[model samples]
Target: MKYCYYILSVSLLILIFSCDDKVDLEQFIDDSEELTLVYSSISPQDTILKVRVLKTLSSDNNIEINNSDAFVIPNAVITLSDATNNSVRLSYNSDDKNYQIEATQLEILPGATYFLSVMVDQREFTSSCTIPNNAVTELAFELTDNLNNAGDLKESVTIRFLDIPEASNNYIVGARIEDDAFDLFLDFENRRFITDQIEDGALLASFGFFNNNPDSVTDITLQVANVEPILYDSLFASYSNKENRQNPFYEVIIPPNNIEGENAYGVFAGFQITERLITYQ
Candidate 1:
């Protein structure tokens, strides 16, 4: 039996795209942290719509996470709605193992806010986010001749984006170097969560990727998302807590969720993503 497996790594705290994080879902089956995880993200550029609804397992359960009968939520009343109250009902497609509606069925507006409601059994989960306008003024990749601390020669990319002018604007930036199946994500600072609270205007960020042999690199991808402020806070707190998790003095902190309901835990946020690809120079 095949199941739609979406990997969410608690240890690495990976959000999405250009990442390869490995973790056994069964290992996180502690009864204490058990809950329903409804994860979804929307983009106008998507070719297929997808969403995940999963139930965590108990410590005593020996069933495999993927093939478990009770793991996936087969019956769900999934709906996506806008502020004006237009809604689209999504059905569980067993072929893809997710509740989805074809992209052709609905017209999604760029930089527009939308809401998600997932009804499972007697409970309902809800969350929403605004897609960013993605008006980037300047996006350039810079490669330097200087060697990194490891003495390995490498290249870096710098992005200067016209900040989304909002009262409370927040973003998640990710960069990775790729060549076919192999991907080298810029670590030590992967997926930097930032805000424009202190900014006067526009923002700039940079990341370096391993490139001992420049010919081995093909292209670099930069994914910049103007995520919701609520989603921004949750992601920031989650990674911050990871640093202190080993400290005996610190209390365990479960990252806050935007989804509102009993036994509902996870994010249903949309991404207004602006991706730029730069060929190795």
Candidate 2:
């Protein structure tokens, strides 16, 4: 497969290191009540929104939980309420082990908030997030192998767009490159966060980066997403924990934002996405 590149920024790295991990050893509390683990994210652009629900692992049952059926919570009731206050319950597909609801049923709208609730063993997990009102405008790109200020040979793509002035917003741009018969999806590690602090709402934003593997990119399709802060924070913590697995001093995973309760873990997020395709010449 060819390579899809995501240019990472310093702020994104900071977020990943800052948030709490969704899955980590610290969450394995000794309490008799099994803490419910939840993960879900939704977008108007998605056809199906899925939520993964699981119980915190215990010392004795940790091995057992590793089995597919043993870990998955069967018949869990997952409900999603739309901006109109209408609710749609997600059905559990035992085959996929996820609670799923069709996107059309949710009626995801811009600038609207959506709520998610899960009933597991009589425990109710609830969380809410608003969809940001913005889309990638004038999205265009150009590839170059030009030398930077450091005078090193750098192959990069210049991604330019307009930032909508809203409360504070975070953005991630990803590229899937097609070369020969292979289609390579960009790795999440390459995701960068775009913040609108300085310009407020008046600035043109451009994100560009040196290609890590230039030869692997021939044609690319870029997906720019305006992500909710909670979603961004959750991914930061979750991905950070996964990336630091090789380190000896691994910090416990910080639990994700589960609005259901303080100890609840996982994300209920929304994204507004815009896509553009550019072929490398």
Candidate 3:
């Protein structure tokens, strides 16, 4: 009788362990698989739209579908709105990973507001920007024969407006010379100036009188880089010898957007008189 009772207790213990194991298995089976989709708009401000879609694994269960591969949505729809509140639809480009909208459809204009909205996998994301007006300040280097001028020479000749000043934010300063005789664009690639938060200050472009060209007056203009109004007229103008123009000097003070308004901002514009222009005497 004693042996039978011990055997029965062991059997009960085994049954309890087996039931617990089964319960865990059922819990695992009851869990549901989850799916998520992500979308990004590369050019949020321009009508020439670009978007990337990604589908990610959201569940721990082993699913049979190929999650490693990126499924292209050929029929994804995109829309862009202009500053005038007009919106146009864009079609997906089958040849690439993005959907492109025609620039002509939006009638991209300077100082116009714009926004981009993308739909992928039933999820939507959007961004907006007021197309910056053509805000450029003119800079000219006036060389004087006198060498006693110190403060004037130390001053920055190029004047520009800062849109943002957070660390790692990049700003582009551009200059163009426009005269009735010649409309010249400076070589920004060879002459473009860039500043970072580490070198915090108002946006400026500087040219020293020490480089010669005493009478040259540079008509300067500054705009946000890569968005509109081709910074350099052409690749050739980047290195051309077009003479600087005088009169109708360009200057404007742009109030920073809300994001950039907190910091102290001012326009730094000045010129220095250096050595006389030498003609290879």
Candidate 4:
């Protein structure tokens, strides 16, 4: 697949890295209780929101992604409650093999807290998460047509956007490029979740580089998502674990989960997305 690029400012990088905590290994304890294994996330833009009820994993905690039935919970009753306190009972979609309800039936809004409950075999699991407010404005980007170091056609970029003001808010940022036949996503090793505590709510700038194919991009987009704490912490820790896998001194960090139930495990959360797109000129 073809590739696209974006850059994080050097000063921002320094500030972000400075938050690297000195984790004391021996002082850490595993007092946290494990809960139910279910997956669910809601967004205003979704046509159909789905909640997957998963089976318990093996002793080694290994999951087989391709085996649908091995992990799917049978006869689970799932319900979603919106901000207005209206609850909807989701139906199991045989096609998708998951519990779902149409987004139109339940209007979800940013800054609203929602609750998810699942019942399986007389046991009930529940969790609640707040959708963060979309505080980021439209991302401003300047693109230049160019040939990358690989001699392929590419576009270079300079991007700017406003920071989310709340320190509790952790946002995920990424870029994507698309053509009619294919789309490419961007990820950086140096950056994953960004929260600017030092210059919260201030305008921030970033720079970039990319590789090109199909000669040019048909469209490009910037995705900024502000998410709640458990979801943000879970994703942030997962990203760090992936990046540090090659280092000998690396310690694996478990992603924080919010689901609550006996003999269950997993997290349920929501996302508020802000996206801006630009077509090739």
lDDT of 1 by residue, 40-112 (tens): 7776755555676777666356565555455777898888888888888888878645778886665667778
Clashing pairs in 2: 20-254, 21-253, 21-254, 126-260
Model 2, poorest ten-residue lDDT window? Answer: 5-14
- lDDT per residue for candidate 2 within 1-281, as digits (tens), equals 22221111112222212111122322243455545667676667777777777655445544532354545677788888976779998888877677787788878778788888888767777888788886656576666554554686656666667787656777766655665544334433423456676777654444445334445666666666778887777656656655776899988566456567644656677777777877666
Worst 10 residues of 1 by lDDT: 4-13
TM-score of each candidate structure, all chains considered together:
0.74, 0.71, 0.34, 0.72
Name the lDDT value of residue 164 in candidate 3.
36
Regions of candidate 4 where Cα sits further than 4 Å from its true position: 1-36, 59-69, 94-97, 144-158, 166-168, 176-183, 205-216
lDDT of 2 at 251: 88
Model 3 agreement with the true structure over 127-236: per-residue lDDT tens digits: 55544343233333432332223434322233334433333333333433333444333333333334443555455443322222313444433233422222122211
Question: Between 1 and 2, whose lDDT is larger?
Answer: 1
- Of the candidates shown, which would achieve the greatest TM-score relative to the real structure? 1
The superposed Cα distance between candidate 1 and the true structure at residue 7, in angstroms, equals 11
TM-score, model 2 to reference: 0.71
The residue-by-residue lDDT of candidate 4 on 1-281, one tens digit each, is: 22121111011111112122221112112323322467676766567777867553332334343444555666899989976789999998776557888888888887788899899989999998777666466788776554544585555665677876665566666566665554334433235466676676877654345433534566667666666666667666656765686899988887676788886656677776667877756
Candidate 1, which segments miss by more than 4 Å at Cα?
1-16, 20-34, 63-71, 91-97, 133-137, 145-154, 176-178, 181-183, 188-191, 211-215, 241-253
Candidate No. with top lDDT:
1
